[model samples]
Target: MPLPNGYSINAASSDESEDAERLIETVSVPPQCCSARLNLAVLMFFGFSVVYGLRVNLSVAMVAMVNNTDPKPWENHSVVPAACPRSSGAENTSDTFQQPDGVPQYPWDSETQGWLLGAFFFGYLCTQIPGGYLSGHYGGKLFLGLGVLGTAALTVLTPLAARMGSYWLFALRALEGFGEGVTYPAMMAMWARWAPPLERSRLMTLSGSGGNFGAFLALPLTGYICQALGWPAVFYLFGGAGCLWAVFWFSLVSDDPRTHPRISKEEKDYIINAIGPQGTGHGWSVPVLSMLLSVPLWAIIVTQMCANWSYYTLLTSLPSYMNNILHFDLQSNGFLSALPYLGAWLVSTLSGVVADKLIEKKVLSVTNVRKLFTLIGQILPAVFLVLVSYSGCSHILTVTFLTLSTTIGGTSASGVFINQIDIAPRYAGFLLGITNTFGTIPGIVAPIATGYFTEDNTLAGWRKVFWVSAGIGVCGAIVFTIFGSGELQPWAVTEEERAETDKRRSGSISQ
Candidate 1:
C-alpha cells in the first residue's frame, strides 16, 4: 500500500518548512507479531479480565454469603409440577459452600440483595462522561490504572463494608462503580492512538473479550473459593490480583505508541502512517447538542440500554435463580451460572469474524449487516429467555435456554456495540461513554427489579422477570432496526475535521 516514489501518506502541504518536510516519511508496513501494539492488546486483554473479575465475583459469592431460611415460606408458592427431581445439591446440604462454621452470613432479603448487587452501577453512571473527556484529553493510561486500582482496593474492603450494614455496603460499592466506570471509555481513548486503521477492530475485540473471559473463569473459581476457603477469600484474592495488575499497567504501558521506549522504529513509523490525526481536544470540543439530536445515536443508546437490561438480569439475578428456584448448591450454582458466560465469550469472538467476512464479501451494506446481527442478537435472546421461563424444573432445559440466550446475545458486540465508532470515529470514546452510561442503568435497575419481583423465589415470579426482559429486548431490536445507520453523520465534521478529511482524501487520490 505504500505510494509510488515513497510519498508520505498524510499528504502534507508542499509549502512545509524544511524540518517539517524532513519529518514526513513514506508509509511503513505493520509488524504481524511481537510488536508493541500487539503487546498492548495482550496486556489490555488481561487488564479487562482482572477488572471484570472484580465486577462479577459478587454475583457468585452472594450465594454463599447470604443465609436463606430453610424452605418453609416459598415451597407452596414456588413453581408447580417440579418434574425434575431435586438435585442432591439442594437436598444433600451436608454442607453447601463448605459453610465454614465461623463464616458470617447476612440475613438480607431478596430486594436488599438486589440493591447490593446493583450498587456498583450507581457510581458507574456518574463517572462515564467525565471519564471519557478526561481520558480523551489527557491520556487514558493514568485514569485506567487508577480506576482499576480504586475498584480493587474497594473490593478488598467489601466484606468489611457489608458487615458495617447495608448502607455502608451501598456506599462502598457505589465508589467502586465510580472507579470502574472509566474503564471502557479510557480503553477507547487508548485505542485512538494505539490502533492503526486496519488493526482497530482486531485489537479492540481482543482486548474487550476479556470481560467475557473473566466472567467465565471467575464464576467457577469463586465458587470453589467460597467452598474451600470462604466467601471473603473470593474478594481478597481477586481484589489483590486487580491491585497488582494496576501497578503492572503503570509500569509497562504508555499513552501514545510513538512515545513508547521499547517500540521499534519501523513499527512506530508504520503505526503513525496508518493512523491519521484523529480526535479533537486541544482547541476543539464535541458538539453535544448535535449528538443529542442524532437519531442513529439514540438508536444505539436505546438498543444498548435494552440489550444490557437482559444481560444484567442474567448477570446479577441468574445465580439467585439457580440457588433458590432451581435449588442449586453454591458450587453447582456458580458453575451453572458461569456456563452462559463461557458460551457468550466464545460466540462473541466468532460473531465479529462473521460480520467482517460478510462485509468483505459485499453481501450486505455495513448498516444492513449491523441491523441484521443486532436483530439476531436481540430477538433470539428474547425468545430464549421466554423459553427459559417455561423450562420448569428441568435443569438441563433451563441451562440450555440460559446458555443460548447469552451465546446468541454475543452477536450484539458486532452490531450496535461497535456502531458508535462507525458513525463517528473521532468521538468514538465519548460516544461509548454515553452509551455505557445508559447501559449501566440496566445493571442498576435489573437486579433491584428482579429482587422485587422474586421476593418468594416462586416460579411465577421468575417467569414474569423473564417475560419482562424478553419484552424489553424485543423493543430495543425493533427500534434499532428501524433507526440505525452505519454511515457517519454530517454533523461529525467541523472546519478542522473537514480539513483533515480533505487531506486524507487528497492523499488517497494521490496514491
Candidate 2:
C-alpha cells in the first residue's frame, strides 16, 4: 500500500500488520452509523448528571446547616483556645459571636462565610488547566470517573466537617471543587469523540443541561433531606449517589470509540469521518498561544464570565434571598428556588435541539444560530435583571424576573458550549478550561460581593448587585456579537500539520 503524506509503512511482522488492518476495518464507522456512540454518549451524560447533582446539593444544604443552632448549649458556646484566637490567621473574628439580633450566624461570621463560599472557586479555578491537561493525556473516561469518585468522597466528608467545625468545612468544600472541576472538560472531550458533526450542538446541549437538572433537583431534594434528617443527611445522600455513579461509569465507559467493545465498526467510522482527520491527536499540550490570540475565544470567555456571575450568584445566594427577602418558609424556599433551574432545564433541552435543526436544515449558519441564542439569552436576562432590581419588595414580580433571567441564561449552553466544539474539536477541552477559568472569576467574586451588598438587608444594596449583573450581561452580548464566529481559523492548524495527521492515521490503519 502507498504511504500517506507524513508516514511510511512499518517493518512489522505480518501478524501485527493484519491485526492493525483488521482493527481499522472494524472501527471505520460511517458518519451517524454507530449505535454504540449514542449509548456511550447517553451513559456519559448520566455520569455528568449525578456528578452535578451531588455538587450543587451543597447550595441547598447551606441554607439549613449554616443557620442551625447546636442542640448542645455547651457546643454552641464552646470557648476558643488562646492559640486559636478569633482573629488568628484567616479566621473571621465575627464568626465566634452570635448576632446581636439573636440570629444564629455561621460559626465563622459574615467574613468567614464569604471566604467559605469563595474558597471553593480558588481550588476550582486552579484546577481547570491541569484538568484539561489530564483529560488530554489520560482520556476522558478515566479522569471523569476518578473525578466523580473524588468529589463523592469529599461530599460525604462535608457533613462530618460541619460537625467538627468551620475550618474543616471550608477545607472539604475546596477539595470537592477541585475534584468537580474536571467534569466539564472531560464532557467536552467525550463530545469531541462521540458526537457527529450534525449532532454536536444537540448532544452537547443535552449533556450540559444535566447541570441544570442537577441544580433543579438539588434544591428540593436537599431541602427535604435537611428537614427530615438534618443537614448532614443531605451530604450523605448526594455523596452516596455520586459513588454509585462512579461505579457504573467505570464499568461502562471507554475513551475512544474504537476501544469500546460494544460499538459497531460502521458507527466508529462514521464518528471519525464526521470529526475528520484532525481529531486523532490526544496530547497534554494544546495550541495555547493560538487560542489565547483568537478573538472568538476571548469573546467566549467574556460571555462565560457574565453568564456565570448570574449563575454562581443564584446558586450560592438565592436560598438566602428567598428566605430573607421573600419570607418563604424552608420548604417553600426550596421548592420556589428550584423553579428557575427547572425552567432553564426545559429551555436548554429545547434550544439545543432547535439549534441542531437550524444547522441541519441550513436555514441558519452555525454562527448565526449561535448568535441568535446568545443574544436572546443575555439580552432578555439583562432586561429582567432591571425589573428584578426595581420591583421593590413585590415578591411575585421579583420571582418572575429571577425565573426569566435564569431561563434566558440557559441558552448559553447551546451557544457557547456547542460553539467550542465547532471552533476546534481537538482542543475543545482546553478551550473550555480556559474559558471556564475566566468565567470562575465571577464565581469567586460574586458571593463575597453579594454578602457585602446585602449586609444591611436594604433594597438599595440589593438593587446595586442586580444592576451590576445587568451591566455585565449587556457587555457580554455586545462582545459576542462583535467577535464570535463559528469558523475555525486556519492558524489553529497548518496545512502541513493536517497532512501529517492524515498520514499518520492512514499509515496506522493500513499497516
TM-score of 1: 0.88
Model 1: ten consecutive residues of lowest lDDT: 14-23
lDDT of 2 by residue, 244-296 (tens): 88888888787877688787776665666555544544565677787778888
- Whole-model lDDT per candidate: 0.79, 0.70
Clash counts for all predictions: 0, 10
Task: Work out candidate 2's RMSD over C-alphas.
Answer: 10.1
Point to the candidate with the largest TM-score.
1
Q: Which stretches of candidate 2 lie over 4 Å from their true place?
A: 1-34, 68-108, 494-511
lDDT of 1 by residue, 1-511 (tens): 2233343222233232321332233345666589888888888888888888898899988888877634432354343332234556453241334457788888777888999999999999999878877877777898889989999999999889878988998899899999999988888878777775444556776778778888888888988899898899999999999999987899999888777999998887677655445533322478889999999999999999999999999988888888777777777778888998887777777776677656545566567778998999999999999999999988889999999999889888778887876566657778889989998999999999998888766788899999999999999999999999766566654454456546666888999
Shift of residue 418 alpha carbon in model 1, Å: 1.7
TM-score of each: 0.88, 0.83
